[model samples]
Target: MNTNNVLRQITYEIYKQRTVMPEKMRTNYRIERANGGLLCDLWFLTVGCIHDAQGGCVMCNYGKGSGVVHWDKILGELKKIVERLPWEFEDFLLTPSGSMLDEREVSKSMREDLCGILKGIRTKRFIIESRADTISEEGLDFVKKAVPDAEKYIEIGVESSNNWILKHCINKNTTYEMFQDAVQKIHQAGMYVTANIGLGYPFMSEKAAIINTVRSIKDVLNDGADSVVLFPYHIKKGTLLNVLSENGMYRCVSFWSLAEVLGYFSETELSKIQISWYKDYFGEEKSYICSSPGTCPNCERKVLKELDEYRETQNPEIIRRLREYPCSCHAEWKQQMDRENGQIDIKRTEEEYRKLAEIYKTDRQLLEQEIGIMKDEFMRRYGNE
Candidate 1:
């Protein structure tokens, strides 16, 4: 079967389960201060990301969905979770797989019903997800008229400004132009725009990833997005990334790498728009899986605590301070980065061996023939060695 059919099967299997918990749906909630006050950040994960279902990105396996779920049931489950929230959350952030506003995922009636549901609730701001292609005036109108009391913001997962990475590695069909147009439409609709920039995809150096992400952030903001969210790539179990990692092709971004990216942006640059990391969404655990930046056992907790503070504060000084902290494992992380960039010491050593073989090739048996034999053996054992 093709990728889409495989994804469909996976989603079908998930929906076949008995009851889908909010977390099972990949939904979770957090309380954060936004929109000038503390708000209940409620996230309900729908089946899987729609883009992922349609032969999605390489580094993603979040496509597991329960197929076509009843929108009212989803709303009911969401309402219960909201009511049960302990704090008085004034803002409600609704996140769904792929584009929640996508008609195929959330029908017109579903959007209308969701609007009606929010109309009854007292939310100050409603931040929702939408792919650039899925943004619709009708959907916006439904949300606008239904929740007249709340501010509406649309977040687009532009991922990166580098179309190369988006098309080749990520396989995201959307383009920068499409994203910009979506921002324009959202602005024209009188709603706010938030650009979600992804980091750490294949075929880019650590610096390149950071630079492209920063560029994407600026591009989206310039195009009319009011804020930006940074998502460092995480390795999931069944994604293409996992396969690559198994085949010695990909590595997860280290904390040092993330810090490097964060440090690249000045406070002035970062402050232009509201910025945040996925770490703020579901905590450190959710932000990464295996192959994390190896922090020393002694300072790991302290480092993570400080990192979390920096993520929330966006204080350049915080990142600067974190970057300065001495860690023995940083050398390992640097070496890992080098390996990822194809700068392995073995490659250099292999080059030196080739040079030596060239120099000794004139000798009969002492150096030339023996060196040639060794080179052949080495190359045979470790290609190009």
Candidate 2:
């Protein structure tokens, strides 16, 4: 028998045993490439989760979200990787799921110890994915000590900025107050903030999206977010969204609209504000989709490479359309800044104003059917003065 095959079988058997247990917390994970670099493949052997007493996110699968046994064993596997991999590469990071369930004090101590190990190994960087609510002052302080001087980014799934939508429909159990506090703490820790935001959910509106998107970039969100992940609403299996779809209580955002959202991030206008934060971090382009935020700096570098390639392949027409796209957040921002700076020559052209109106109309027709059935309710849920 092949030695590799035997090892594979043994690993699979162990994964299966852990997975099939009634109280099973561990899950099998695929060793996939993070982005465009080496040493970025997450070898997820010995990975797992600790579930909530209330089950978990209504949108989560017990398999994809779960099936990993524990973060400690996962950490051990990474340590083994450091022992085995080529010496030239940068370090691997540690990230955990169901992060809410981890022992707070122990987690901090473990990360401190991890920092000592990686520093000894001369690793380059480390990052993590966590909940907005879990990012307490104490936790931020701990992470700061451990990851001191590394280029760190924290990805928080903020979902939506609208308190009503996040509270009533999504049931995330987080408050706007908590989100604000987390942002302040993250900033205090001297790290980059990445927001995981979504749009076009059940009661989401184009205008609300515009306002929230702007708030995220301009107000509190701008203060922290280095990159904004514009996650569109996709129907998943065994989730509240899927149930809503089945009962016709919701409609998914169109793929075209989703493209528009991406365009929002790609705009040169956002570049101004994003740059306001990073005075020295200047470049012509917008954000890069870091393949694995918490794991691979190598992949992140490659992601920047690919983003440049993507920008090169696009035509001026697409770019212009993006410039004119409604919520011309970038241009509006420039205009607003110019006004404050006493440079008043900048005004959106009549055509530009009309185009923004057209964008709203087009995006609104997206919810035509459901809105027709529930016009007053839609207005109450989504409209702004």
Give each model a TM-score.
Answer: 0.73, 0.54
- Where does the lowest 10-residue lDDT sum fall in candidate 1? 1-10
lDDT of 2 by residue, 286-352 (tens): 2111111111333334333433333334322443453344444334433543443221111221232
Over all chains combined, what TM-score does candidate 2 have? 0.54
Q: Give the residue spans of candidate 2 off by over 4 A.
A: 1-58, 61-72, 82-93, 100-109, 120-125, 145-149, 204-220, 250-252, 265-384
lDDT of 1 by residue, 98-180 (tens): 57788777677766766655655566677887888888888778657756878887888888875544654466667778888
**Residue 124, candidate 2: alpha-carbon lDDT:** 55
Positional deviation of residue 320's Cα in model 1 after best superposition, in angstroms: 2.0
Positional deviation of residue 74's Cα in model 1 after best superposition, in angstroms = 2.3
Q: Please list the C-alpha lDDT of all candidates, in the order they appear.
A: 0.62, 0.42
